[model samples]
Target: MNKILVLAAHRYPDKSRISKAAIEAFTGLADVTVHQLTHAYPDFQIDVEHEQNLLRNHDTVILLFPFWWYSSPAILKEWQDQVLTYGFAYGSDGKVLHGKKMMVMTSTGGSAQAYTPEGYNQYAVDALLLPFHAMANKTGMLWQPPALVQGMNDATDALIDNGVNYWLERLQELRGM
Candidate 1:
């Protein structure tokens, strides 16, 4: 069985209703490990070796978090800076994540329609997530389309539940679980 790591990096966690719902649906199911970044590093101190080790063991890496300023939280960026080193995650000898799969599971406060060509945000979800896709490509990992839930700011419990279920089903399909 392929091991999956869900790297959850939510800064303002008290406001994360949608992201938590998605996590609750997947935790403790099959070969999965959920790592909460903020809780682990409240002081912004990350154990690079340990984080890299987690990636080394997992076959698929799912970055789960709310979209902050069209990207990931600070801790996630720190993780990428520290763990994805020159000789470990992306050098000539850095083949640790070569065959693994990488994808993002994110929630947004903006409506889905806003992330369109002529919309307010004026960009597709994929366009905003190009950095991640590029990172995956750089590291030789398979870059999967992101699982996005737009408009969580005004979402109801029923909406959150439905979105969570949809995301879970998509994850299972991605991992062939």
Candidate 2:
């Protein structure tokens, strides 16, 4: 079974609907660890070595966050900057993350229709996620299709439940259950 690590980042977790539901759904699952960044590092002082160790221990890595300004929250970016070092996440001798699988789960305030060339965002979500795909490629990790929960700002209970179910199912699949 793949040991999965979920790096959950939310600028305001308390105010979140979709992210909170997803995190709750992941609670107490076998071979799955949900690490909430804001709660763990409120001061934003990421432990690079510890983070790297966590990455090394997990067979699959899931990045869960709320889309902000068409990108992830600052802490996730900071975690990437600090933990994914040249000699660790990438470099001649950096093969620790090789063969691992990566999945990105995100929530967006806008509806699905808003993320298109003719919509308000004027770009597809997949296009906006290229950087993450590139990161996975450069780190030798297999990039899985991303899971997204759109229309977060007005998502109903049923929608939230559906998204949470999808995330839980994905995690279970990753664990080979």
Best by lDDT: 2
In model 2, where is the ten-residue run with the lowest total lDDT?
Answer: 168-177
Give the per-residue lDDT digits (tens) of candidate 1, residues 132-169.
Answer: 99999889999888999888878999889878987887
State the displacement of the C-alpha of residue 5, model 2, in Å, after optimal TM-score superposition: 0.1
> Residues 52-167, candidate 2, lDDT per residue (tens digit)?
99999999999999888999999999999999888788999888898999999988889999999999999989899999999999999999999888988898999999988988
lDDT of 2 at 20: 85
Q: How many residue pairs clash in each candidate at the backbone level?
A: 0, 0
Write down the TM-score of every candidate: 0.96, 0.97
Report per-prediction Cα RMSD to one decimal. 1.2, 1.1
Give lDDT per model, in order: 0.87, 0.90
Q: What is the lDDT of residue 42 in candidate 1?
A: 91
